[model samples]
Target: MSLIDQVLARAAADPGVRGVILTGSRARGTQTARSDFDVTVVVAEQARPWRHSTRTGTLDEVVCTVEALADTSVHWRRYSFRGAKVLLDRLSGGIAELVDRQATLTAEEAVPLARANLDAYINQLYRCVKSRRDGLADAALLDEQESLPWLLETVFALHGRLRPYNKYLRWELENFPLPDPWSVVLMPDQVRLAPLCLFPAVESLARRRGHADVLDGWGSDIELIRAFAGAAGP
Candidate 1:
């Protein structure tokens, strides 16, 4: 009947299927007529053919030529079918449930890691920002500084072996979740990320035992960045 209905129907019949979770723009309901459906189907083991397929245009419903239940393909109609079609799945394990579970960094788990990352990067951010204020007659310094939040978030995400994502901090926090002891009420401001500047963020982290300076000891991190720009810039 519906694309989702057809897909769900197929998934129910499959046994190897472990879990299936819808993702990307489609699941979020922000999809336009041209958006593709992104569903992650999990199986007991990696399906070789599906994993190896190099088809450039699709990820929604590619069927493995060899691994029967392993066949996967995109509904291909979000671009053409509108809301009138149903996409099916053939996951053999509970992987979809695993995805639905999403990752969570509870207060205890995330606070320490976040604080550590913050401390390690704080002085670095200050130096870089200060350096930009001091030596950046060139406009590119501003651009580089602007990109620092992304870098900081990346470090924070990686500091705890966390998942990597972009500016969608709130969505990431609520859906995927993280340990944020201080900001119990507000969403993580990707913009505020700059102001957080790691100094205060890691204040708690530095005082604790066994914590490493995840980003410390590289004061010229900005200079290193500038080195790249100086080498690349015109």
Candidate 2:
């Protein structure tokens, strides 16, 4: 049997192992030939061998209790479990439920995240635009590059989804396109071009989602961004 199959079988047979979850690119079905199996083995307690994670012969293992895993679910690290595959769940579907929670965000959670991302994107975009106009080419390029990821985060938040990691950004976009105009610009062909055009759409979406006040906080920066886009033309 393959290494992963052997690992899963062993994990399943262990009475102490309450669950086994497959994560990373392997779980997402986007693994390259060089990809290693990322597995999480859940136990009832943090005892000897079960407590230490091991990386050996293509198997990358994390051993933790259910409570520890739950704690992880509430933080940014939760994204690691976004598409995790539960190979074994002795907890009667609890593992599956946890994975589901890890993959998405609630409306309350999404709004604050969206606001933060929108603020960050605007910060970078404003710097990029100002730098370009001031003849600071290198600085402009850096700011523009930095803004793209934050722009992506804002879009995902607007849809009430956690933004995928950079490695899975293209895969996420291809498999789960955002609504209409947003998706159009996020396409690989358009992502690098016409970033200024994004500000107006972001404002509209953020406003509709009760974030007009946050946008207002940016004050003249918003006006400057619009003017830059207008000058750049449709």
Candidate 3:
């Protein structure tokens, strides 16, 4: 068996470990030579704190522990080390289920920051459209252009204190970026860009709500942003 498989087998020896999840590029099967394994160790109790440890191997290894298996509210133990594989999930108890959610735990932004992000994305869209209309048809708003909806969703999420995951949103909502007119070219049939690109929109969208009813509020700003973004003509 491979080294990854062996490690997973070893982890299974412990009865307390409930599951193991492999995320990042490897779980997506897009791992490169430089990619390392990210494993979450799920245990039966959250109150148990952990000390870190390193073990020798062809792969760099580290282990952390946390508890309360099968509980929804407790966060899992996170282990990240350099190695290109799934070492093991050997919990004699059972296999830990994997939950793939992004934007899992973000606090909402303040009103000022949210407003700034909204204005910034709208203004960026306007600049691109204005430039294209001015005949720089080749100009595109390439930066911070893809985070529009998730940003907006932050407000929507804050109505309930949930961090809406963009990856999951893509599966459900046909959302737009903090869109510029050039978004058509940069994001034709795509959802979610780099977190860096989505940064401002994420901050602003949540901030606009400012602890208000995000769903029931903020319609005007959303409309205004859309109008500015869509002004580019064919």
Question: What is the clash count for each candidate, in the order shown?
Answer: 33, 0, 17
Which runs of model 3 end up more than 4 angstroms from their true locations?
43-216, 219-223
CA error at residue 193 for candidate 1, angstroms: 8.4
Q: TM-scores, in order shown?
A: 0.49, 0.89, 0.42
RMSD of each: 9.7, 2.5, 9.3
Candidate 1 shows a clash count of 33
Provide the lDDT at 82 for model 2: 77
lDDT of each: 0.43, 0.80, 0.41
Of candidates 3 and 2, the better by TM-score? 2
Q: Which digits, one per residue and each the tens of the lDDT, describe model 2 over residues 56-108? A: 75778889877777663355667788778998999999978877776768888
The digit string of per-residue lDDT tens for model 1 on 121-226 reads 5544544555555676455345445545544443443344343344234554565454564223225454343333333333343335334444444455634543
Which lDDT tens digits does candidate 3 get at residues 30-124?
Answer: 45787665555555444444322333333444334433323334422211211113334455323332232221333432343344444544445
Best by TM-score: 2
The TM-score ranking, best first, is 2, 1, 3
Rank order (by lDDT, best first): 2, 1, 3
